[model samples]
Target: MRVALELVKEGRAEACVSAGNTGALMGLAKLLLKPLEGIERPALVTVLPHQHKGKTVVLDLGANVDCDSTMLVQFAVMGAVLAEEVVGDQKSPGGVAQYRGRRNQRPRQYS
Candidate 1:
């Protein structure tokens, strides 16, 4: 992770993609890349096979086992940002579009 981020930061690489341990990736990515300005937590996203049309992207897949609504919202934001970044447009699904941030309202009290 450090090496990948270093490459990007040093102008050796334009972008980076890694697939490994989720917890490890999150820890290392946070350490190297830091969170986006408005993003509270970085999300790990994947496109799954859908029965219908296009695939669905789910973020933060078990990254933080313990739950927080705000964090979930941030995941959606990050995931959408990722999609748009990849396709080079943040308009609509015709290419790639701004995603609806799927965040919950607040923290929940559990007993």
Candidate 2:
């Protein structure tokens, strides 16, 4: 994992995709590639198919066991950008939901 990440860090590779230990991948990515400015912690984002159409951008995926409000907002912004630029979606997703336990069904709004 470190070797793959090192290649990206040295510019020998553009990106490193891993299906290994999530914790180890996140840790090494932070150590080698570093997070972007204003990003408290890098998010592990992926695309998932929407039930009706298009796709959904999901993030965090155990990258951070807990996150403050600011971190949540950052993840939302990053997800939106990836959806727009990468996924080529003009409109944003339906909403951003905060997962807590299993009964929280409300979407989180940041002021």
Candidate 3:
């Protein structure tokens, strides 16, 4: 992941994508890659597989499961930023980031 991010930093790649454990990946991303200009938490986002490239973005899958309403709003904020990054340019590598937390951590999404 570090190598890939280095490539992006060096302009060898446009973005980084991963499908690893949400908490682990978010932790690693926060450590390796700094947050976007306005992103407080780098967030874990997931893009579901759909026909014709259709999908939904889910952020903060389980990183902060004990989250309050404000935390949920924060997830939406992170998701919006990720969606923009993904939709920014087709040529860009990161299209839409999403989160898939552990089986022991799924929660009801109200948004």
State each model's CA lDDT, in order.
0.62, 0.77, 0.59
Candidate 2 segments exceeding 4 Å error: 10-14, 101-111
Q: What is candidate 1's CA lDDT for residue 12?
A: 94
Could you give the candidate ranking by TM-score, starting with the highest? 2, 1, 3
Task: Give the lDDT of residue 30 in candidate 1.
Answer: 77
What is the Cα-based TM-score of model 3? 0.52
- Candidate 2 clashing pairs, residues 3+ apart or interchain: none
**Better candidate by TM-score, 1 or 2:** 2
Candidate that scores best on lDDT: 2
lDDT of 1 by residue, 41-94 (tens): 666666666687545566665566554556666766776776677633364332
lDDT of 1: 0.62
Report how far off residue 104 is in candidate 3 (Å). Answer: 14
User: lDDT score, residue 67, model 2?
Assistant: 70
- Cα displacement (Å) at residue 13, model 1: 3.2
For model 3, where is the 10-residue window of minimal lDDT?
Answer: 89-98
What are the per-residue Cα lDDT tens digits for candidate 2 across 1-111? 999999988889877798799888887887878665777767888899989888888877667766777888888777877888888987875354546423354356689
Q: What is the C-alpha RMSD of each candidate to the true structure, in Å?
A: 7.2, 5.3, 7.2
Give the C-alpha miss distance for residue 50 in model 2, angstroms. 1.9
* lDDT comparison, 1 vs 2, better candidate: 2
